[model samples]
Target: MHSAIAPIPIDLIPSWLDVLAVWATVGAALVAAVTGVLIWLQILQTKRSVDATEQTLTLAREEQEQNRELIANARKSRIDAELPKILVWIHTQTRKAHDLGVRSASGAPRPLTELPAGKIWSLPDDGASELFISLTVAVSNDGPRRARVTLATSNNSFLLSENEQVISVGEETLIEVRRKYTIEDWAAMSSEVGTRSIQDVLTLTYVHQGTEGAIERWVVRQSGSPLVPVPGRQNCWQLGPFAARRGPLTSLTAEVEMPHRDYYSSMSDLTVLV
Candidate 1:
């Protein structure tokens, strides 16, 4: 009877800590997921920013290259614009040289002056009996710092002029002087001349020089004679007083050594005196 009565009520204790631990575990899982998502988003944003910056830099570099090209082209245009004016000045000077030659030849007290006015000679369109003259007269700048000319000949050797006087960077000038050609008498020789015919190897030598210097001898030859000759000397027989075996012939060959240059202009209607 006593044992049965003792089966009294036994109380069970509740664990509050266990419930709190379960809630904490769920919260931690939520926090971890949010953190991982935020990291991924940050990486994507950083990549986008870098790509944008690079594209902007590339475009800016291209713009700079274009600007440099434009500047270079502008400079070239300016130089071209100035060239014509310079040429006009040179012609003015050439006129002055011609006037001087005439004054000196007239036996008048040479005008104590250098002025633009003179006769410039060119060959006749039909040709000459004794001279080969220039039809294509070229004036040119031999170097950026120098100028020169070439008298384009018909039957004579090339005529080139050296840069005699200094033509400054921006300065334009003309060179003028009289060139004289004298032919020695060829008729006085006896018919008993040497074995070679007088019609062979006859020629002369002339000179070219700077504005103020001694002239240098250049060779000349006639058109009808043998085109080739001894190198150093001008053969007078090349000048011709020839009796053609078959056909009638007129002009002879002549040449003048001229300088070579870069850019040039031409003047026409030059008159040549026999």
Candidate 2:
């Protein structure tokens, strides 16, 4: 009986409820598709935001490094500006004749004329006679700072200034060096004239006053070419062009311990001069 009741609706049209159910199903599918698209767009937008943030952070880091480098360079420039600049050159040289156990000649000191910059001179030299050479060196400050300067020579025979000299900017001072050599010493120096040139090194140590009253130490080394024997002059020699170089400052103990006889003896000589 139950089965016969159901067979009577075979040819009937669809009801409003059935049609409404079908339309509702189609609408649900459309909403789901729109929601899926919106979700994908949101994910893409989130990814772009993350990438933009990374780029900004990377740029910021690069800028920070650049700023650090700039600051370091500025600091170095300031320090370099405050350093002392010193120049040294041989101003004049004079030769005086001396007899054994006798006073030097009363006449004015004879100036040794320099030949061409690189050429040797021709002068007469008395054999077996004592000689006195007086050298006047000019020291100048070319920088904006003032410094206390001390000088020493590589040769132990040359006497230099005793105390530290305060040199002001653009100011020049003269330092006198006097050396007495016997005939034996002169002969020894002359023997090497052709084989090798005799050279002397001059070292200048300075104390620099920097910004904020900071103290710094520096050194400059000056050397001249080997002494060339003057033709027709016995025991007479002349120096060539001079050159200077800058180096790091060293401690007093280290300087004293160096192999240079002049440097080691300079400390004792300074005391004697004082």
Candidate 3:
């Protein structure tokens, strides 16, 4: 029926101030929700930035390592290019020139006569009385190219006399160096040549190919000590472990060139008067 409805209850109807308060509360909640979402987004951006920085550092380290390796390889290559290719080794001289032979009764070279006491080989009474001593240095060409060797620093060692002035060498070449001796050099040396690993050393200037000036230095070791002079032969000394072991006759006297008698002898064996 169209009867008039009783007026709506006023208490149930909210006042304007209450309605404004409700609106304000809703707005505050929305603001708080938006602020929380923004905070979450910022956290994600920060994490991404940290990961990017770490990646960059990793790349830099890898690049640095690669550069170091490249630099080391470059340096090694440079050295290989600049340095000359030469190798050297030394040992006793055992080889002899068979052509210059003076066979004795036993078909072997005779032993050098021990000089008489107080008699010098230098001021020999006869030309035949004069003697020769040598160092017998060995040389080899241990390079890819041909080389020529010239004596550079020979100290004129009384024991190591210099005779050969210059020598030539080819690739993979080897040679026994021979030298002559003079008694004038005897003054610098002791009567007894001492025992040592190497008797002495000689320095050589190696010229590569046609180059006149020296390009590199070459060092050679002297043969074993106590060179026993070959007899009947002017004054050639025998060098080698075996020759040195069978050295110095007890019956022979010491000479001016070689002052050591290594072994003792009797008075009757003394031939020439001093």
lDDT by residue for model 1 (201-251), tens: 111211222221111122222232311222354432222222232233333
Task: Give the per-residue Cα lDDT of candidate 3 at 210.
Answer: 21
Compose the digit string of candidate 3's lDDT tens values, residues 1-274. 6999899899989999999999999999999999999999999999999999999999999999889778756644543343335444433333222212234678764333333322323223232321233333345543344444555434333222243333333444333333333332222122344443233345555433221111455555443332334445553433222222113322111111211111111224422211
Model 3 CA deviation exceeding 4 Å by range: 1-79, 82-84, 91-130, 133-149, 153-170, 182-201, 207-215, 221-274
Report the lDDT tens digits of candidate 2 across residue range 86-168.
66665554332233332336754444333345333333344444554445666788878786876666553354447578899
TM-score of each: 0.28, 0.40, 0.30
C-alpha displacement of 110 in model 2, angstroms?
A: 14
Top TM-score prediction, candidate number: 2
Number of the top candidate by lDDT? 2
Lowest-scoring 10 consecutive residues by lDDT in candidate 3? 255-264
After superposition, the stretches of candidate 1 with alpha carbons farther than 4 Å from their true spots are: 1-16, 80-274
- Deviation from native of the Cα of residue 263 in model 1, angstroms: 18
Candidate lDDT values, in order: 0.32, 0.50, 0.41
1 versus 2: better lDDT goes to: 2
